[model samples]
Structures are given as structure tokens and as C-alpha cells.
Target: EALDGGPLARLHDGDLVRVDAVAGTLDVLTPGVLERPNVRPDLVANGYGTGRELFAIFRDHVGAAEAGATPFF
Candidate 1:
């Protein structure tokens, strides 16, 4: 399934979820379900890969400068 956000977010109204299933119709599952398919397709397929890449970038950016300090609360 495709991750949400990124280029898809700008072009689409909702999040950029992956195409989980598209057999005769589009079967999408996002954080929330608020929309439905407009038309059906001829065949369907299933695949999986990284959903989003931005989160990784942010994590790496924030994770690199940890100062090795701990909280005392």
C-alpha cells in the first residue's frame, strides 16, 4: 500500500493512501474512510512498500542531534 501525504496530499483532498486493492474497483484503507470509488477497473493487483518517505527524513533529521541528555522530571 502507498503511504499518505507527500505529492498525493497536494493533488488529492484526503491523505495519500496506497492502492491496497483495485480489482474491478479501488479498495483503499486510510486512517479514516470518508470516500468511495467513482468507477470500476478491469483488473486488480496487490503490492506493499514504504508508505511515506517524509517521516523517515524527519526522524533522521531529529535523531541525529540527540546530545545524549536525559530528562529529570
Candidate 2:
């Protein structure tokens, strides 16, 4: 699975993370050794142009980021 903000925050720039695709798991070798990367969380909430309202439906209906964020129920 994709390691989002929480797990990513615990890893350093050079740290290694092992992902066992077969087992569907990940292990962070060195955690909390480096700072998290800067992100624009506010921008996500601000919406984009006039299409923002139109796209809200898709956004709300979409699945997880790693799961293609599709509008498939």
C-alpha cells in the first residue's frame, strides 16, 4: 500500500523502506530521523478555478489516492 503523510513523516531523505508486494506490507528501517517534506495541504482545500465545484462530485466519490481515485462507487 502507499505510505502517506504519517508513515512518510517518519522517514528521512536517505532512509530505505522495504515493501513486500507479495505480503502487502512495508517496513521503515529508520524512522523519525529526518524531517518530513514540505507540502501544500492548504492548496488542496482551496480548490482549483471555476471547475472546483464541478469536480467536487468526483473528488467526493473518488477512492484512495493509490487506488486510482476512481469514481467507481
TM per candidate comes to 0.18, 0.39
Enumerate residue pairs that collide in model 2.
Answer: none
The residue ranges of model 1 lying beyond 4 angstroms of the native Cα positions read 1-14, 17-22, 35-73
- lDDT per residue, candidate 1, 1-73, as tens digits? 0122222223335555555354533344464444432333322232223654534444333421134322221
Error of 2 at 58 (Å): 7.7
Report how far residue 42 has shifted in candidate 1, in Å: 32
In candidate 1 the C-alpha lDDT for residue 56 amounts to 45
> What are the Cα lDDT values of the candidates?
0.36, 0.63
User: What lDDT does model 2 reach?
Assistant: 0.63
Please list the Cα RMSD from the true structure of every candidate, rounded to 1 decimal place.
Answer: 16.3, 6.1
Scored against the true structure, residue 32 in model 1 reaches a CA lDDT of 42
Clashes of 2: 0
Model 2: lowest-lDDT 10 consecutive positions: 1-10
